[model samples]
Target: MSGSGSRTAAARAAVGAVWSSVTSACWRHWPTWAGWAAGGFSLLYGLLGLYWTAGGDGFPFAPVDPARASGSILEGSRVEVVAPIIAVLGLVGAVVAWLMTRRARPGRRSAAALMVFGWAAAIGLTVIVPDYTLIILVAFAPLLLVFAFTGVPGDQGGIGDILYWHRTNLIIVFVGGLLWATATLAYRRRARGACASCGRRHEEGGGPSRQTLLRWGRWAVAVACLAPLPYEITRIAWYLGHPLGVTPDFLRMMQDTPGMLEVGLGCALASALGGVLTHGLVARWGETYPRWIWFKAGRRVPPTLAIVPASIVAVTIIPAGLMFLWTSEARGTWAMYVPSLFWTVWGVALGVATIAYHLRRRGACRHCGQGPQPGPEPRTSLDQRQVRDDPVSAPGQRA
Candidate 1:
C-alpha cells in the first residue's frame, strides 16, 4: 500500500514538471506570446464590452437611456450574457493551444482554431459598439491574434519563422501609406485647383498616371508625417488642464489623447521616401557606395528582401485596420476620432503596396505591375527558383 501511494505521487509530480516545461517553451517564442496577448486581451475586452453594452453597470458603456434600462445588470438579458463568457473561454483555450504547441500535445489545432474564433468575436464587438477608439483597437486585433499564433519561431510547425519577414513588411506598409496619402490629397487638390502635385489632370484615356501617383505619394507622406504634430499639442494641453482622476470633463478629456499615431505616420512616410529615393538613385547614377557599405549590390536588392518586409506590413496593417473598424461606435465626429480615418487610409495604402510589390517581384513590369493576372491553368505550386532556394528546406539556407 505504501509503495503504491508513493508511485502515484511521483507520477503526478512528473506530469506537472512536463506541463511546466512545455508551457515555458511555447511562451518563449514571440508569435506565441502575440497570440496569447491577443487572445487574452480580446477575451477580456470583448466580454467586458459586451456586458456593458448589454447593460452591466460594472463595466463602462452600459445602456444609458432610462427607457431601455433593465433593473439589474443581468436583468432582461438574453444569451448576450454568454458572449463575454465565451470570449474568455476562447482566449483561455488559445493560451492552452500555445502551451500544447510546445508540449507536442494533441489539442494545438483546436486551440489555434479557438484563438481565431476569439478574435472574430472581438472584431464583432467592435462593430457593435463603433466608438472610434474601440473600432481602431478591435480592427487591429485579428492581425495581432494571427500573428501571435504564427509569427514566433520554434520547433513546432505552428506559423513558421516570420520575424524578419514581418519587419520588412512594416517598411513596405510605411511606403504604401505615404504614396496613397499623397495620391488622395493630390486628387483632392487637383479637384480644388491647389498644390502642384495635383495642379493638372491626366491626359484623355489615361488612368492614374505613374508620375502623378509618385508625386502625390510624396506629398501624402509629408502630410501624414505632419498630421500627428497637432495631436502632440493636444496631449500637452490635456496634461496642463487635467489632474489625475479629478476633472469634471474626465470622460470627454480621456478621449483626447495624442498617443503615438503621429510618430508611426512619420516613420512610415520616411521609410517610403527612403525606399523610392534609394531605388531611383540606383536607377540613375551607377553604384554609389557609402563608407559603411560592405557590398556593391547597389539597388538590385533580392526579391525575398523586399517581399518579406512587404508581407510583414500587410499582415500587421490589415488586421489592425479591421480591429479598429470592428471596435468603434458610430457616434463620434470625424475630428474626435481622426486616428481611425488615418489608420483606415494608411492601411488600404499598405495593402495595395503589398500586392504591387509581390506582383513586381514575380518578373512583372516594374513601373506598371498591379498583381498576377488571371489565367487559364496554373503552373507548379511555386516557381522553380523559389522551391530550389526556400529557406525552410534548402541546404545551408539563410533565414
Candidate 2:
C-alpha cells in the first residue's frame, strides 16, 4: 500500500511540473502582436523591393525628388536593383519567423521552421547580393529580439524567475550579428584604403602577421558590442561627400569600390576571436582567474554568462566564415564562378574551436574526473578516526 501511494505522489509531481511549463510558455499577448506586425511589414517590403529590383525596367521607382515622396514610403531615386531585392527577401523571412513565434508557439516545429526559413533567406541573399550582406544582417534582427524575449526549453518559471532562460540563445544571436557586421566593416575599410585613385599597395610589410591576427581578434569583440557602427559611418561619409551633386563621378567611384582593409582584417580577426572567446574563455575560466594571475583565491562564476557568449560565437562564426568566400570576391564573371573555398576553410576552424570550447566548458577533462559519472549515491562526512581506520580502498569502494 505504501509503495503504491508513493508512486501516485511521484506521478502527481511529474504532472504538475509539466503543467507549470506549459502555462509559462503559453502566457502571451504582446509578443504575438509585435510578431504579427513585424511579419506583415516584412512581407510588404519584400514584395516592393523585389518588384523594383528584379522586375523594373531600369532603376525601379526612380523619383525626381526622393525626399518629397507621397504616402508613408520614403522615396529614393536610386536603388541597387539586385541588392535591395535580396534584402526584401530577408525581410520576408523575418516576418515569417515572427509569425511562427506566435503561431507555432515555441515547440520543436516552430523553432525548426524559424531556423529553416532564416537560413533559406540568408543563403538566397548571399547568392543574389554577395557584396551587400546587410540583408542577411537585417534578417537576424527580429529573430534576436524573439530569442531575448522567449523562454528556454528547460526554463520552468515566470519572467521574474532566477534564470533568464533564453540567455544562451540571445548570446548566440549577438555573436552571429557581431561576426557578420565585423566582416562587413572590414570589407568597407579595405575598399576605402585600396581605392585606385588614392594610392597603390606597397609590396613590403603587406602580408598578415601575428600581431595583425591579434588585432583582428580584438576587433571581433569590439564590433560584437557595437555592431553596424562602421557601416553607418561609411554611409554617412558617402552622403557627406555627395552633397550638392558637386562630385557625382567621385561619389559613384567611391560607391563602386569595396570597404577599407582595416575593416576586413578586423572581420577576419573577429571571426577567429569569436571562436576563442566562446570556447576558450567560457569553458576554462568558469569563475577561476587565469593561473598566471596574482590573485590566488578560487571563485565561482555564473555558468550561463560563460556558456552563452561563447555558444553564440560558435554558432555564428562558422556560417559567416563560409559565406565570406563568395561574398568577398570583386564583381565580375570570373569572380562570380570561383568557389567559396577560403571561407569554407575558416568555417572548419571555427567549428572545431566551437566544439572544443563547449567541451572544455562542460568540464570534460580526463585527468579532472569531471565528466558524467555513476548514479547519485549518498555522501557521508567522517571524523579523522574513521579516515585513519579506513586508510584508502579501491576506486569503486565505499567508506
Candidate 3:
C-alpha cells in the first residue's frame, strides 16, 4: 500500500511541478503582449484605410453583385462606405487598445467598452468578412508546391495567380482581427488586477479557477473529437470504393479525375490523425511523456508541441466550414458538403480545449510569484504519511 501510494504521490507532484515551470520556459516573453499587435498594427492599417478612402487602388472590399458574392458578409459593401468605416475604426481602435494596455487600469465601464469593441472587431474580421477562399488557399498550399514540381494535369496558375492581392488583402485583415482578440484578453487580465502574463491573483477570483476550466474543456474536447468524424467518414467511404454521399454519376466523374481516390484517402487520414491528437488535450500523456518514448520518456511535454499545430488547424477549419455552408460548388448537392455541418463547432471546441490545456498546465506567474492552485490531493509528508497509515485514504485522490 505504501509503495503504491508513494508512486502516486510522486507522479502527482511531478505533474504539478512541470506544469508550474512551463511559463518560465520561453523566448523573451511579454507580461501580456501589451496590445502592441492591436494598437501598433491598427494605427498602421488605419492610415492605409484613409489612403483607400482617397483614391487608392487596392481596396479589397469593393461592392460585389449579391448573386456572385459567396457567404462573406462584406460582399456588396461599397468602398465609399467601407473605407471610411475601416479608417475611423482603425484610428479609434488604436486609441482604445493603447488605453487597454496602460499600467493604470480603467474603470469597469471603460474596460467593458474596450472589451466589447475589441471582441466585435475580432469576430467581424475573422468570421463575418472572410469566406472559404482563405480556407482553400491554406489547405492546398502544400499541394500547390508539389504541383509546381510535377506540374498539374491542367493549367496550374502559380501561387501569385491564385492568391491574388485581393485574397491576400483579406488574409491581412484576418491577422488584424487575431491581434485585437489577443489584446482584449491581455487587457482583461490587467484590469482584473491579476498578473498580466499568467492572470493569477494574489488571492483567488482573478477569473475562472483551474477546476472550472477542466470541466468546460472536457465538453469542448468531446465536441471537437466528434466534429471531424463526419468529414472523415465521407472521405473513407470514397477510399473504400463505396462513395457515401456522391451520386453514382458524380462518383464516376470524380473517379475519372486523376488522383481522386488518393486525395480522398489523404483527407481521411489527416482528419483521423487530427482527432487523435486532439484527444491528448485531456490525457495524462499530454502532461508528460509516456514510458514508450525513447530518450525523452517521462519528461514533461513542451506546451508548444501540442498548441501551435492545433491552433493552425482550428483556425483553418472555421473559415472552410463557413465557406462550405454559405456558397460553394456543392450548393445544390448535399453529398458534397453536408458532412461539414459541424466543422465550425469542431473548430470552436478545439480552440476552447487548447485554452483550457494552457490554463491547466501553466504553473504560476514568474512576475507575480503565484503558483498552481491547490489540489484536493494530500501535499506534505505528514499528510501523505497519515493517508498511507489509514488504508481507506492511502490511495488519495487522482491528480
Number of the top lDDT candidate: 3
lDDT of 1 at 121: 40
Candidate 3, 73-165: lDDT as tens digits: 565568898888888988998998888778886899988999999899888777666766666666678887887777655554556555565
Candidate 1 weakest ten by summed lDDT: 280-289
| RMSD (CA, angstroms), candidate 3 | 10.3
Q: What's model 3's lDDT at 201?
A: 75
Relative to the unseen true structure, what is the C-alpha lDDT of residue 199 in candidate 1, on a scale of 0 to 100? 33
lDDT of 2 by residue, 15-124 (tens): 99999987655432223333444345456546656665665543323453422221112123366744385456647655564544442234556555555654454333
Instruction: Please give each candidate's TM-score.
Output: 0.29, 0.32, 0.77
- Candidate 1, position 236, lDDT: 41
Return the number of clashes found in candidate 1.
31
On TM-score, the leading prediction is 3
Clashes of 2: 20
